[model samples]
Target: MEDIPQKHEVINWKLEQLLVFLQYCNYKESMKGPLFYAKILLFGEYGIIKDSKGLAIPFNSYKGALKSVKTLTGEAKKSNSSLIGLYDYLAKLDTELVDFDLKSFKSDIDNGMYFDSSIPQGYGVGSSGALVASIYDKYAINKITVLENLTRDKLLKLKEIFSIMESYFHGKSSGLDPLNSYLSLPILINSKENIEATGIPSQKEGKGAVFLLDSEQIGETEPMVSIFMNKMKNEGFRKMLSEEFSIHTDACIEDFLQGNMKSLFGNVKKLSKVVLKNFKPMIPSAFHKVWENGIQTNDYYLKLCGSGGGGYILGFTEDFEKAKNSLKDYKLELVYRF
Candidate 1:
């Protein structure tokens, strides 16, 4: 026989092994969880608010997922702390349209659960939208699964639910961001009430491209939106948005969807011009000349990727090489090619 305390020592070792196994399980589950990707609103930035067409596509460059941790630290700790606020907000939500498993959500949060994400916040790339998608995916009871046939009614229902949920982050939300991230598909907004899944032309080997120009700064949606609301009070600005802005935006969407690069460039240039002339406050002052130069020269056309106080500026060009050469000083990320 062994020492008198050998039995207790064996029990301790077994308990340690069990703890490791549980941790391994948690890690496995986290790894297997679905990743909600960031979304890019290619068209209909401010115009969508006033019932204009919009097109959004899932951008896999940045993504987020629900994860469990043995000990939350660093970004994970910060994320966990922030989730408490969301949990409180969700727990008190009075919506009869959907219900979340608050008990399980709270228990997970208490056990050091956090969203593992690389999507930058306040960048207009749907950072909070992805987080909201992750939570709804995991904790919502009778949640709408992506596998089902997403009829127009179902799509609207999901958007409604997401709008209410995401409103906690932004003062007001259209719900398009979270819906795009959640569905992982290109979404076309015909208007505020009519939205449907859409398919864009497959990427091709060509010179023309769509890219993101990094402003190297974060953008807050609330303030930018407030600025837009204040501008809407002016009759002239409202007419410009409805007549010039919306017209160009709708044409761009149509051209893009139809793969008519020739028409797309023409309309995108017009849209870029309108944005520069009117939405001056939305554009970062540093890039004011950069925006104008793109319009002056046919090298490229730049527009807002989101609300655009300071985030990524979307660019379109017939020849990316030329646009790259012209904007050589700035960091450019290619999003699409045609």
Candidate 2:
């Protein structure tokens, strides 16, 4: 007797059929896999790129899941069409190191199968990362299992693969976002290339609250990063980033890890000021006054929750009611109450 093919296997079979059609017409692969929603580093943006300690978590507000459908609707079809070009490129690349059931993968993609996710693009969340992780999980042969022991070496290997996978969206990727998605854990670290999962300080009563303030605009990360890179070329900017930004960022990370609430907020105050002075362009024009107001009044502190420009602005408030009152005109999404 033979075992029945599982639902996923059935879907894979359908995908293979579609791939044949696409290959016949010379269409390329597009999506790596379905991805879930990811939250941005409300405080760490350019700071993280410089190896300043950063923190990010999964945002459940929006999520995406992969499933093969007989038909796609609206944006789904359009997204799938765009992916064809990407898949074509991947097919031509040296994918010997990565594991992918390319034959079936191509078929599903060709048959109009697309990743159906609600995670918004260009908000600095790991939208592409989640998709990359999903693809690796579904198709990679001898893949790393989330259930198995994840040693540092395995984690590093996973990051390398994900970085390659996610490069399709961003011209370059650090692999941190997808790595976080793959592990679904709060990742803490000393540097980009050096990272690990660690425990976070729990919120305490009467402590500050970490929240998200929606900028109501979409932020394109590639451009923002480009700007930051150009700025890095300046000797003065580099000095300020290393001397001021890195100092504050490192202090905040250490204090948070040590569970020193007072020290964390103090360092966060400095971090907030530094971001306001250096990252003026990333903040939406409408929020400029508020950004300054928070720094001056200390009613609330604003940080780059993700890549800045738009989406959600990470806010830290000692008093939620006070912070709300201060920014009564804008919308606020509570993330964590510390």
Candidate 3:
């Protein structure tokens, strides 16, 4: 008789835990859900692969969401077909490590499912990342939500999971893109082992700004990555990466985070030069002169936005209107202001 209340208390505690678990389960559909956005690797680029620090920020100008439709048609059908392929992949993934509610996912596919997205593919922004985030959100069982009490272990675990999931698109993935899009927050990669969500200096509506220059052509990441991998074979390239590439990239990250704008531009210029001289094949020929012109004139500085083969060229300028006037021929979208 004495143990009855104790057992009742234990049962009540478990019920409470079960209620919390149920709340987390319905957190997405019932309340605020996810709308994953594109991500911009503002710094590091290829250098991150060489163990350099990287900074990534969410680009909300484009985003993707998972939705249900009455019928699949047009591009939705094509996208649905692609998702079916993903379904096959996820079904085979190890359940102990990362499991999804595949039954529901398959049913959704059968009932006309598609990822309606505005994210441009192979444009250096995270198109596949948005898809990975969406899939994880809808299907991943016992998934870690950004809202949970987050620890470094949990963060790393999430990144590991995302890497495997995103690898379906890119032959290999750092998991940074999906992580950035999942959190929709600026992420600072101190190193591969040390990464955390970080806050950047608040935007000031001033003449100085960061912007994206449209290359107007698709940049395939896999081949660009392959090129980088091939370049890794050269000792000179490795030396340049260690001494110049990583140096400029790390300095630029420090300068940007510290809001040392004057110094930031100098480091950015050095980075632009390094990328131009070393990463020539990655940059389109048409923009090479202009990329150099910016370095010469100081109107703006250009650097690779992603893997660089083609997509968006990241730019920084002391004066936006002046930069705009100088770059009138090309499409420039402002990303950040200072």
Q: Write the per-residue lDDT of candidate 2 for residues 110-202, one digit (tens) a residue.
A: 777666667777666777777777777777888988899887778778877887777788777778888777777877756766777777766
TM-score-sorted candidate list, best first = 1, 3, 2
lDDT by residue (tens digit), candidate 3, 32-138? 33689999999989887877899999999999888667778898898999899999988887746688889999998998888888898888999998899888977
What are the TM-scores, per candidate, against the unseen true structure? 0.91, 0.84, 0.89
Best by TM-score: 1
Model 2 scores a TM of 0.84
Q: Quick one: ranking by lDDT, best first?
A: 1, 3, 2
Those runs of model 2 whose alpha carbons end farther than 4 Å from true positions after fitting are 1-35, 204-207
- Per-candidate clashes, comma-separated: 0, 15, 0
Tens digits of per-residue lDDT for model 1 on 249-268? 99999999999999999999
What lDDT does the true structure give each of the candidates?
0.93, 0.76, 0.90
Query: What residue runs in model 3 are displaced by over 4 Å at the alpha carbon?
Result: 1-33
Q: What residue pairs are clashing in model 3? A: none
Query: In terms of lDDT, which candidate is strongest?
Result: 1
Global fold similarity of model 1 (TM-score): 0.91
Error of 1 at 217 (Å): 1.0
